[model samples]
Structure formats: C-alpha cells, structure tokens
Target: MIRYGILSTASIVGRFIAGIKESQAGEVYAIASRTVAKAKEAALQYDIKNYYGSYEELYEDENIDVIYIPTVNGLHYRDCQNALLHHKHVIVEKPFTLTSIEAQKLFDLAKQNQCFLMEAQKCVFLPTTLQLKKLIEQNVIGDIRYIELKAGFPGRFDYDHWMYDLSMGGGALYGSATYTIELMQFLFDNPHFQIDGSCIKCPTGSDEICNFQLKMNHQILVSSTIAMNVPLKNEAVFYGDKGYIVIPNYWKSNHLDIYFHNGETKHYDFPYQSEFVYEINHIHECLKQQLLTSPIMTPARTMEATHLVETLYQKWQEDTNE
Candidate 1:
C-alpha cells in the first residue's frame, strides 16, 4: 500500500483523510504541522501512525511513498519542491503555483527526480465530468462554438483571511475561477487560449470578481465570470450547433442535462461519492503504473491553468496601476 504523508492540518485536509479512509490502495501514514500539539491532535483525530512538528521530518522519513499538500496557496511551490527533492511523489492542491514559471520549474524538478506529481484537481475526475468528456468526444455537442461558465459565492471572508491577501495568491481568479478555467481546458482539450478580461479587487488587493473571455483555436469563444461578492448559478453550458449540455455545480457535478434543437431532452444521473475519492484512486493507479503524472490532470494542463490565472492577475494589476 502507498503510505501517504499529509503536510498540513488545514481544514481541507479532512476531506483528503476521508478519501484515504475510503481507498484501499493507500493509507494515512503520517501527518505534519508547524506545532507538535497540532500535529498530534490531527494524528489522533485521523489515527495516523506518525506525526511530525515540521514538514522536514515527514520528508526525511524513508517510508512515506507520497506527500499530500493542502497548505496555503503561497506555500505550495516551496513545499512541493522540497517533497520532490526528497524523492517523494506529491499531490498538491489546485492553483498549483502562483505562476506558470513556478509550475514549470516544479514539473522539471519532478522529472529530474523521477517522481510523480499532480495537481489535486478533483473536478476533472468526477464521474459526471468523465461522462461529459465522452459525450463531447462522441459529438453529443457538435462542433462546440460557445461555452459559458460561472462560479461564485456570497462574500463572507474577513479582511485578514488569506483569500484576501495578494501575497497569499488569494483572488477570485485563483480561488474560484480556476475551477471553470481548468474545466474548460479539460473539456475542450485545448491548452492554447487567450484571455481578454477585467477584474474588481477587494480592498486588500485581491480580486473580488473577474469576467473574462477566452478564444481558442477554431474560433471557440468561452465567457467566464467568477466572484466572491455575489452568488451565481455556478453552472457550465456548452452550446453546439446540434444540441447543448448543461451541468450544474460542474465542479462537483453528479448529473447533467442535454437539450437538442429538435425538441429532444435527455438527462443523465450518476452516483455521487466524495470527488476526492476519484482523485485519490487515480493517484494510486498512477503510482502502480510508475507514471510520473496523471494523464487526466497532466502537468501541461496545470501549467496552462496557472498561465491563464497569472495573465489575468497581471492584467488586473496593470489596469489598477493606471
């Protein structure tokens, strides 16, 4: 079994711990936090066999087959780099790095170390998403021309939260919009896209809302809007010449609806388990196959998403500066 070491006691870690409990191929072998008390508390809560007060201790443990990082967005690069350097496979949370350059560097390091590395993007592994991919590939939506996606929630975070800290890689583009960006990339199978957009920033300098238009090869137009100050439909729709597919809560979808111009409507339903389970299982399979990265959530895809986010943020910064 793959022995998994988690690098933080962040709230998100609980979801992954549950995923580990549900999977047969791996188990929570260790957990680490900046404080011994916190580490020990989490270890007891999860019944982990080993607990460390520092990430370095987990990295130095030879028995850990993989490391799962759910730390703050800003720390992802450093932690991932260290884990790879220590020869441990890593599964890092989304918004893998603050920039494409950092993502490229981490990917290169993983290659050099011959270790597995993946962005923990659980949405792409959802059964509904996989099914949607199949339908799109089968021309269920013929020759996609336009795509619209939006994700947002009502504003609730305080000023001091990392989500509002620019230095922490906090913004609607990175925190909320990334799901749609990555989903669009996965669904369209296109990494080459351009963005023209604008953003509204919070007082703390992080983006509160973003509206962007993307144009891909073949003149595919994708419009996306993400915000933290308002509630949106949080859905994605693909419009084709023959029909359209609509997925609600596309990021963690379990069902979809298809409508045709000819007045035919079809609905598909899927079982819903924690989406994390699918990602965890995919990682387990990749490890078994000795693969360096998951084909579903590839390094190229991660870089593409990072590049888009960085570009949008830069554009926002420049606009704000002037």
Candidate 2:
C-alpha cells in the first residue's frame, strides 16, 4: 500500500485525508503542520500514525511515498519543490503556481528527481465531468461555440489569513478562476486558449477579482469570472450550435443537464460525495503504473492553465492602468 503524508493542517487537507482513507488504496501515515500541537491534534483526530512540527521533518520520514501539499496558492511552488527534493511524489493544491515559469521549473525538478508531481485539480475527476467529456467526444453537442463559467464565494478576508495576502498569491483570480479554466480545458479538448479581453482588479490593490474572455484557436469564445467578496453561486454553461449543456456545481457537480435544439434535455449523474475521492483514486492508479503525471491532469495542462491565468492578470493590470 502507498503510504502518504499530508504536508498541512489546512482545511483542504482534511477532505484529501478522508479521501485517502475512503479509497483504501493508500493510508494517511503522517500529517505535518507549522506547530507540533496542530500536527499531533490532526494525527490523533484522523488516526494517522505520524505527525511533524515542520514539513521538513515529514519529508525526511523514509516511509512516506507521497506527500499532499495543500498549502495556500503562493506556497505551492516552493512547497512542491521541497517535497520532490526529498524524493516523495508531490500533489500540491491548485492554482498550481504563481507563474507559468515557476510551474515549468517545478516540472523540471520533478523530472530530474524521477518523482510524480501533479496539481490537485479535483473537478476534472468528477463523474459528471467525465460524462460531459464523453458526450462531447460523441458529438452530442454538435459543435462547441461558447462557454460561460462563474465561480465565487464571499470570503471573510482576514489580513492575517493566507487568502488575503497578495504575496501569498491570494486572489479570486488565481484561487477560484482556476475551476473555470480547468473546465474549459477539459471541454475543449484542451485547446490552445488565448485571452481576448478581461476586466480585473486588486480592488484593495493587493488581491484581484477578474472578469475575462478567452478565444480559442477554433474561434470558440469563453467568458469567466472569479470573485472572493461575494456569495457562492457557481455554474458553467456550454453552448454548442445544436445544443447546450449546464453544469450546476462545476467544481463538484454530481449532475449535469444537456439540452438539445429539439427541446429535449437529458440528465447525467455520478457517484456523489462531498470530497475528492476520485482524484485520489486516479493518483493511486498512476502510481501503480509508474506514471509521473496523470494523463487526465497532466503537468502540461497545469502549465497551460497557469499561463492563461497569468495572461488574464496582465490584461487586468493594463485595463486598470488605462
């Protein structure tokens, strides 16, 4: 069995730890936090065997085969690098890196170390998402034309919180916009997306909320929005020439509806869970196959998403400067 170590006490790790337990493909052997108290508390609460006060100590544990780095957005790059350097397969939380350059460098390091590395973008693993992909492949939607995705939650911004710090890469654009981008990638056969227009802001001059549009090489138009100081109502709509598809909760959708031009609609459902067991299961399968990255959530796709995010930020800045 693959023995996994989680490199955080971040709330996100709780879901992942539970997933590992549920899958039974791996065991949550260790959990680490900035403090010994937090680490031990989580270890006991979760029935994990080991706990570490610092990430380094957890990395040094010879028994750990994989480490889940679910830290905040900005820490992902450095944290992932450290985990890989220690010879552990690394799965870091998404908005994978602050910049595409950092992502590429991380990939190079993982390659040199011969360790698996992937950003934990879980939405792609949802059964509804898979079904959608299959439908598109089967030409159920005829020809794809436009996509609109919106994701946001009114986060209580605490200056002390990592999500509120720009240096920590805290922003709605980087943190939440990623869900939309990942969905777009999956729907469009991972097409080459180009940012055509955008409205973005660090309203507090520190963190950003962006509204952007992208143009695919094939003339498909995609619009997206990400915000933090807002209510949580997330959805994605895909419009094709012959039909349209609606994903209610794009990130963790269990059911999606497709509407054809003939006024007929069909619903698709997948196994339901509040956590991301599917992605974890996929990781287990990849490890068993000795694959460095998942075919579904490859490093190349991660870099592409990051690059698009970076491009959106640039356009946002330019708009603000004007």
Candidate 3:
C-alpha cells in the first residue's frame, strides 16, 4: 500500500483521511502540524500511525512514499518544494500556486526529483463531470456557445483567517474560483482561455468578489462570478444551441441534468461515499503505472487555471489603481 503523509490538521484533512482509508491503494500513515499537540490530536482522531511537530520532520521520514498537503494558500509552493526535495510524491490542494510561475517551478522541481506531483483538482476526475464531458463531446448539448459559473456564501468570513489576507494568497479568486476556473479548462479539453473583461470587488484586504468574462480562441464564451457574503446560485450552467446543462455545486458535482429544446429533461447521477475517493484512486492508478504526472490533471492544466485567475487578480489591482 502507498504510505501517505498528511500535512496540517485542517478540517478538510479529516475528509481526505477518510477517503484514503476507503481506497485500497493508500493509507494515511503519517501526519504533521505546527504543534505536536495538534498533530497528536489529529493522529488520535484519525488513527494515524505517526505524527510530527513540523512538516520538515515528516518529510524526512523514509517510510512516507507520498505527501498530501492541505496547508495554507500561501505556503503550498514552499511546502511542496520541500517535500519534492525529499523525494516524496506530492498531491497539494488546489489553486496549486498563487502564480503560474510558481506552479511551473514546482513541476520542474518534481521532474528534477523524479517524483509524482499533482495538484488536487478532484472535479476533473469526478464521475458526474466525466459523464458531462462525454455528453458534450457527443453533442447532447449541441454547440455550447456560453458557460456560466456562479458561487458564494451568505455570511462574512473572519478577517483574521489566512483566507482573508491577500499577502497569503487569500481571496475568493484563489480559494473558491479555483474550482470553476480549472473545471472549465478540463471540460473544454484544455483550450487556451483569454480574459475579455473583469469586475472585481475588494471590500476587505482581499478580493471579496470577482467576475470574469472569458473567451476560448474557438469563440466559446465563458462567464464566471465568485463572491463572499453573497447568496447567488452556487451552480454551473452551459448554454448550447439545442439545450442547456446544469450542475448544482459544480465543483463537487454528484449529478447533473440537461434540458432539451424538445422539452425533455435528462438526468445523470453518480452516487459516492467520499467525493475525494475518485481523485485518490486516480492517483493510485497513475502510481501503479509509474507515471509522475496525472494525465487528467496535468501540470499545464493547473498552470492555465493559475494563469487565468492571476490575470483576473491583476485586473482587480488595475481597477484599484484607477
């Protein structure tokens, strides 16, 4: 079994650990946190075999074959770089890096170390998303010309959290927008996307809301909006010539529906225990074949998403300067 080392005791770590246990390919053997007390608490809570006070110590363990990093947004690059230097296969949570440059460097580092490296963008590996991609290719939603992704929350986030600090790469664009931005490239088959226009809000130190109107060179229009403290519909929609497809909470889509011009509606469902399992299993299969990069979640795909969001953030800064 692949011995996985987990970083941090973040809330998401619990779900990830549960998923690893569900998959037969890997086990959460070791974990680390800034404090041994926190690490020990997580170890006891999740039944992890080993715990360390610092990430450096965990990365030094020879028994750990892979490391799953769920660290803060700003720390992903440095943390991943350290893990790769130690020759550990790595899977870091999404928005892989704050900039495409950082992402490129990490992918290059992985190559130098000859270690498997992937950003955890699980949506692309989801069954429902795969079904949607198949349907699009089959032209069930004939000639998709426009796509819309909308998401947000209804309450204010704590200003003290790392997610609210722009210096640490905290913002709606880097955090929530990662899903829609990357999922678009995946569904559209890794096309080059260009930003046509943008409207970003920065009520706090970080961007609280972001809007981007994008165009694929093929003339496909993509519209995306992500916000904090707003209650817009949290879904993704594709508008086609014949019909439209809707996936509620598109990031973690379980099922979706298509409405036909003929007044017929079709539904697709993919039941699952933990949504993280599909991505984990995909990694397992890749390792079984000795592949360093995930074919589905390629580094280029991640860089594209990072580039797009970074561009949008730049637009936000330009607006502030104006």
Report the C-alpha lDDT of model 3 over 197-260, residue by residue, as the tens digit: 4555455668777777778766888888888757899899999999999999887889999999
* lDDT at position 133, candidate 2: 87
In order of appearance, the predictions have TM-scores of: 0.94, 0.93, 0.96
By TM-score, the best candidate is 3
What count of clashes does model 2 give? 1
- At residue 256, give the lDDT of candidate 2: 91
lDDT score for candidate 2 against the true structure: 0.83
What is candidate 2's lDDT per residue for 67-134, written digit by digit as tens? Answer: 99888788888889998999999998888998999999999999899999998888888888888888
- lDDT values, one for every candidate: 0.88, 0.83, 0.87
Residue 32, candidate 3: alpha-carbon lDDT: 100
Residue pairs that clash (backbone atoms under 3 angstroms), model 3? none
Please report how far candidate 2 places residue 22 from its true position, in Å.
1.7
Off by over 4 Å in 1: none
What is residue 78's positional error in candidate 2, in angstroms?
1.4
Per-residue lDDT of model 1, residues 1-322, tens digit only: 9999999999889888888878877899999999999999999998898999999999999999999998999889999999999999999998899999999999999999999999998888888999999998999868888999888877667778998898897777888667877887787785468888888887898888888988887478889988889999989899999999999988888899999989999999987556688889999999999999989898888888888888878877888789
